[model samples]
Target: TSIPSLPGISTMESLREAMPYFELILDSGCSQRARQFLCTLLEPECQPLGSSVTPPCRNTCKVVAEECSDFIINILDLSQIFKCDNYPDSEDECINLARGDQCFSKETSCGDGSCIPKRWKCNGVLDCKNGIDEVNCTTCNKYQYACESKDSCIPLEWRCDGNADCEDGSDEINCHQEEEMVMHSHASPCPAGELRCVDGRCITLQQICDGNKDCSDGADEANCRIQYKS
Candidate 1:
């Protein structure tokens, strides 16, 4: 005889109550794909409890039914697993997971229940507490370079600039090698008494300690220390 469908998972509370049964299914030698699908359904329960949201739970159930249909056919019924009287019926009642904070006209929700501006997503900064906003981003903005870990984004001009702008130091790695490769090909060099900046520009020594920046790379004003002679 076929097993009866498990209780509805339309709410976090119900989902939590159903976990042990799911775990039983997992331990009973379910296929790897079925196990992963079950884990996705259980993810929200793993999060800290907050104001209950139905859309994400419902969406997850939909994915399980569509993607794991064959695997779940005899083991569980999708209709009973997804049924929840409390599920939102009206569009207005469902909160948008992608909605931004009040300050931002557009926002996206993080896995941790925090909201951030849509523009901040995949911009390289970990605005979300769990860094979920920047995860799985395949591309970056124009003139922006993706970090070596691909977890963040930086400006293209920041690459190979002798500064560790990326969290992983990818922006400065191999910078000297690149400079050595192009040094002989470039005609730019400092004049006799001027210091050469990282960007190959020349500036007077006096400009180095005058509380002003003369080089595009700002190398002239960095690491200035006063010297004394007895």
Candidate 2:
């Protein structure tokens, strides 16, 4: 098993004991995500540095839990041992399998029910499952305003004008002066290079795309593009 497995099973004896659980999943022909998730935790990728071990992302575990719950939990009677929340969701890097992805508070969405890191949104690659992250990366036309949802382009004058031109009502998510002031005040408390959440929480830039919501407003992970870096 991996050094820091969710189950804390690091010894070969423990791994052999866990073999039955994995065999059941393999025999069931579960989704690739589920299979890969189990394999990653049970037999993680070989890295030169032990600290380089990459655990499965929490979101991926959640997906697998939901997808294979009936089999791994109900049918296999392993609910007591295989809870998905045992894994770390953030504060460090982990393996990411972008499906059923949810954005963090104040974080941008890919307009297709998936969320990514702000830096990855249009860094010249398609990170969103539907390629929405790369769309409209450029500024809208002279007369148009880019919607907060990043899925639509509308007339600039339509913004904050009391009309709902954007489908997500994001055109007015921050229309109140009090809210802007709150954002500004909250921002002041955060150190430089750190993102201030809508609720006044400070998070590191490294935490942005680690597949977790560090900010209550979810701003730390908005528009994160998932791409292989060279």
Candidate 3:
């Protein structure tokens, strides 16, 4: 069900508790699409194939969020739960009101008024009609790997070093190496108890998996299981 949805409200109790916050938004009339958007999340229409509930379109979420940014962020204190960037920008099978074409959150607009997923921008493939998405884009050199999330690149050795050097974690997503094997780069000699990064940087054993990228290549905090203190 959409109750235990992407915001980590995983039970009926949590959904009930969160209802008042949404109700406030409904009462405020912050955006025209707020009611429909909120209802779609609350009681979703199920897909026939896998009984999956399709989420609201990223554009719809973006529209509402932009119009109601002040209320949602300052008053209700709900920016963390209402991140529009979490939604997919693809127009395929997602829920959106019947309107003229427009760009939404996590999407980039082509020069010819067409919208493409933001991830497709600067991906080396020409997805835009006028190629504006690729224009002025930062191309990574041979020694660097381009990050799909933004127009930036990290060192080639940073990929799959157990740390997410790329902001979107694309560098660490499909890594094939084991974590234990990845820990030992063997590139440089450390002072007895430290691990050597692929680029010859040394970090202490306590720094490993400690929720911080100590090494420049991010070998310190790779494959971590982030959890609550309780």
Candidate 4:
């Protein structure tokens, strides 16, 4: 043992002095050769958790080195235990586990049956009272909506100007996808939606001067009533 021995020191208090150097020996946790020398040097025990007569503590690990020699031995590779996802953490029935129940002023429960995150998903009649909760609910139809009042599963807002904002076609009805028009005075095609994705890449005169085509169809540099030098 390279550790300097103490003469009459007893209890965990004495063992603390030599631990820093001993820890340096196992600092390379991957080395088995180092471990062998450490085991011989420290002499730990492989005692059962509760079977130990001496209390286990930080300092006690060094003091009880011989008696608990096997305990300190990293003898084998052990896989960590993993619990199943669906398994309840504890078997105790005394716990009062409320999932997402919030405390309101009055004891009024939103009668959407299951307490899903969104109140609109609960049922047809605005369980959340405010229609905005259901206004932006997910919908599939382009012109139709999943209107709360109608409470129909299918869409109802289908007059496509370009937007499918609401089931009732009440929000922005005549919205178009806004395609860019091509120009003749200048060069380059200004396509509509294509220009949105790009920034001032290379646009043409017909796309811009004609107010149509700096973009995909000349929509990008379109509609510049006043023409400037290239």
C-alpha RMSD for every candidate: 18.9, 13.2, 12.4, 24.0
**lDDT of candidate 2 over 104-215, digit per residue (tens):** 4434577866555544555466756678777767566645655544556776556557888877664453445323423655426655435466777766433544557777
What ordering of candidates by lDDT runs from best to worst? Answer: 3, 2, 1, 4
- TM-score-best of 1 and 3: 3
Candidate order (TM-score)? 3, 2, 1, 4
Show where candidate 1 strays beyond 4 Å.
1-135, 186-230
* Alpha carbon lDDT of each predicted model: 0.48, 0.57, 0.62, 0.31
Model 2 TM-score is: 0.38
Angstrom error of the Cα, residue 165, model 3: value is 50
Give TM per candidate.
0.23, 0.38, 0.40, 0.17
After superposing all C-alphas onto the true structure, candidate 4 shows an RMSD in angstroms of 24.0
Best by lDDT: 3
Error of 3 at 157 (Å): 57
Candidate 3 vs candidate 4, lDDT winner: 3
How many clashes in each structure? 2, 11, 1, 53
